[model samples]
Target: MSLIARTGPQEYECRVGVLDSLTEKLRVRGITKVLIIHGTDSWDKAKNYLTQLMDSDITLEFALFNGECTHEEVDRIVGLISQTQAEAVIGVGGGKLMDAVKFAADKSSGVESVLIPTLASNCAPWTPLSVMYTAEGVCLGFVIHTKQVNLLVIEPNLLLDAPVDYFVAGIADTLAKWYESDVVLSRPEYQTNALLLLSRAAALNCRDSIVNYGLQAVKDIQNQTLTPAFIQVSETIIAVSGLVGGLGDGYSRSTVAHAVHDKLTAFPETHTFLHGEKVGYGIMVQLAIEENWAEIDRLAVFYESLNLPKTLADLNLSDLTEEQLGEVAAKVAVDPILLQSQYRVSKEVIQGGMRSLENYLATTV
Candidate 1:
């Protein structure tokens, strides 16, 4: 019999003050010695809560994250974990740090990992994949590990302290889960796959939650008040959005939107944009490629509402000549991941889509 392995974190906890109980959680997991891999800024913000862990019997060590989730960094941390003989790895910070720790722990057998995210920026903590990047911050691709995370702890109050842009970027990223996957799921060959059906429902749920509660959630964040709406949206971003990929498997993989984001990373100027912001514009390009003008209009209104990128100008690529933009389209057309789409995509198609989007934006403005 063929066996299918489904992976997820062994334990997950989300609450307002969960950080204060990190020691007890580790104790229950029988992790007596741990090495913490975290970003410098996040470590500073979380020092107060982290200090209490040291008061317990658990042996703790800290390593400042060097900032990217590259193979070299993973290898370096793997060496540190071996030298420290840590029973477990505690990744405390944003997505990149969590990815590094997860990749390192997965690469080194017998090493367990616990993720504590300081922002609700992406589903990196809940997912089993690490997005590997070049040392220069260019996207190489992602790596899927055989094992899932040991534990995931999310403190909502800690997330509240992150910049508003991170939260907005997260919303944009989560919304793409629906748009990107629904197109693939609608294909005839995938229509009856039970797992994909569940994933489709999850993606729909993500969309509904964001559509119904996103604005209020943004308002709550601006006001610095954690309301029911804010909490729901945060969980939707981190948890519900993750379930889409977790259940969908390969069939639900991101299509054109993320592929465009990866290609845009080739330009240093686009590096200033957040991951989700780039994906936001990518969604627009994908819609244009499908020739879905009405849907594009609706999404454009929503993008404006959330200050998401709706045009090339918003993506900081408006200054590029048509030839330069064509080069980007050619690169995106050839991305191996984008080729997995059920529909046939080509350089000419992507370039045409970009031109159409630009013309549409000009008329609307």
Candidate 2:
């Protein structure tokens, strides 16, 4: 596990008309040339946005991520910046691509970064942290440096068109921090009000957004009605969900919510789902283990209603058979690690949690 790095808000904005703020932020930084990093899945949309920007005096170059990023992709983005000497690097897309850009910026020299998230799946755009992937595209671990993004642009008008699953997954991922951060806050060893404040701020910001507009965001996506829902999601997924939640909880210690995400990823068949979808279910399982079934279950049903995974098989996970509980427990039993959780966590504790999860899935809708 990587050490936690507490980051300041630097700056946060969630008002209407945020996309328009991007141009001025760049100009103030004296950035004349920009290198854009985006994903191939959203290549056309990325191009459209880039074209709009090109109409301005700013020189622009774009690199579409072919698929999952590799060291080569990071190197390529860095190499492009070195060769082009672009004043800044801007990343557009989901969390993974953002992580790629942020890491490359850290490894590079002098070039600052701006983030424009096309989706709100994870708070990657808001945090200074980055997750590095191996050549094969597995998340090797995280890259924790003090580097922070200068500008983050979230246009709900843009994200409202992406699949509803992305919005749902974003909530799922954001919601995990509500539980995980609290778990960290409980630990006697890792006590810091400053840290907890950041974590709780992220949690509450997301919780409030979810309570108010989370359903609206989902309903808007389902109905394809983008007006109010787009506006809400722009803040919920992009601003509140991405930046505030990211700065608050992301830079803090993540307990079971993320650990479960990691362990579940070991089963490659589960790759079809988004990270937040898997993580949402992980939060459910964590809630069950902690014996706080009622609170977590209420949200799990929301996820179920949204068509997120509620069962082990739903995650495409079959390797974690009933017989494998002991091994899973032992593997997860890292001392001071599990202790940081909101509740006491042990091998027996996790086994009980898994058992409860199995039971919960057996009965719930």
Candidate 3:
């Protein structure tokens, strides 16, 4: 048995106005020169929170994140760090920007990294891995960094004005923790492992907390209200969901649900969909593969309420030709995460699961 769990950042703080301490944190660490990489719009949202840091004596270099966390983007940020001789890099945006900064910092020898997420889109701020994609937005898997984030500061006030769709997508992505981890953790062999048990508990907490608070949190963001439910759901998404993979290691990291996501990303028509929206549909596909129609029915109601994708039509892939659909199935059939789960499935099995899920939905509608 092998276990590799990179729990989270060395230091994490989530509260309103917590960013006031950032400059001092850096000063004490002796990080005099820093690189600030941010998204265009995200910078506008987050800049006001960093007034103190901007006024500090520490030297700063700024770079606009190029959107995708591609290898080229990592190389560019790495080059910027080298040229500027930045002692640390700070990412202020959504997941892509944070992932790119972490990857670049890892490649930059002794450079430290800090994250201040402007969007509650995913666990990118808490996790020590970066999900890489092509320039055109195709998924190219992810890389786990050896060095953890030096700090993660979540200014809930900054996220209050974030787009509602991204917040909803975050809920969908975080919910995948339970559905994905249970697929492997429920096995008899994993039942006795202490760490996996903790991972399982954390994953279950993600599901329960999201179910209990998700809708209210949605209303919270829609009205720009900072309520208790909103804070609860936000922490659940970024912190607790992170522990599913953090404690369970590779065993609960991902499975068929994420595999289905990788396959769907190959289609350009699906490019407009968010990561969690795609994974929401992948959950149904995974359930269909296991012939768990009941669970799919239950989740379909929740997914509909959240406006998450539930069908090929929802993903704009209903017009795909049989050959194209077959290609997706074939790719999913051999997905690394799927294979790693020890569940053998053929391309035909995947295609049938898709068809079955559609047929079931047709009956429900």
Top-TM-score candidate index: 3
- How well does candidate 1 match the true structure in TM-score terms? 0.95
Give the TM-score ranking, best first.
3, 1, 2
- Give the lDDT ranking, best first: 3, 1, 2
User: How many clashing residue pairs, candidate 2?
Assistant: 1
Candidate 3, residues 222-316, lDDT tens digits: the string is 99999989998999888888888889878888777788888788889889988888988888888898899888888888898989998999999
TM-score of each: 0.95, 0.86, 0.98
Pairs with backbone N, CA or C atoms under 3 Å apart (clashes), candidate 1 = none
Which is the leading candidate under lDDT? 3
Backbone clash pairs for candidate 2 read: 183-342
Q: In candidate 2, what are the lDDT values of residues 1-365, reduced to their tens digit?
A: 33354352355554435756666667888999999887765656645654446677888887776456566778888998998889889888888888788778878878887877777677777777776665544455566656777767666656766777887888777777667676655556645656556556766766776766777778887787766655654565545544443444443446666666665655667677888887787777778877887886677667767787766778777557766766656555653335544345777777788778877767865
Candidate 3's TM-score reads 0.98
Candidate 1: tens digits of C-alpha lDDT, residues 279-299: 889888988999999988888
* Candidate 2 wrong stretches, greater than 4 Å: 1-24, 135-137, 186-195, 227-230, 241-252, 323-325, 335-344
Clash number by candidate, in order: 0, 1, 0
Query: What Cα-based lDDT does every candidate model obtain?
Result: 0.85, 0.68, 0.90
Cα lDDT for residue 29, model 3? 89
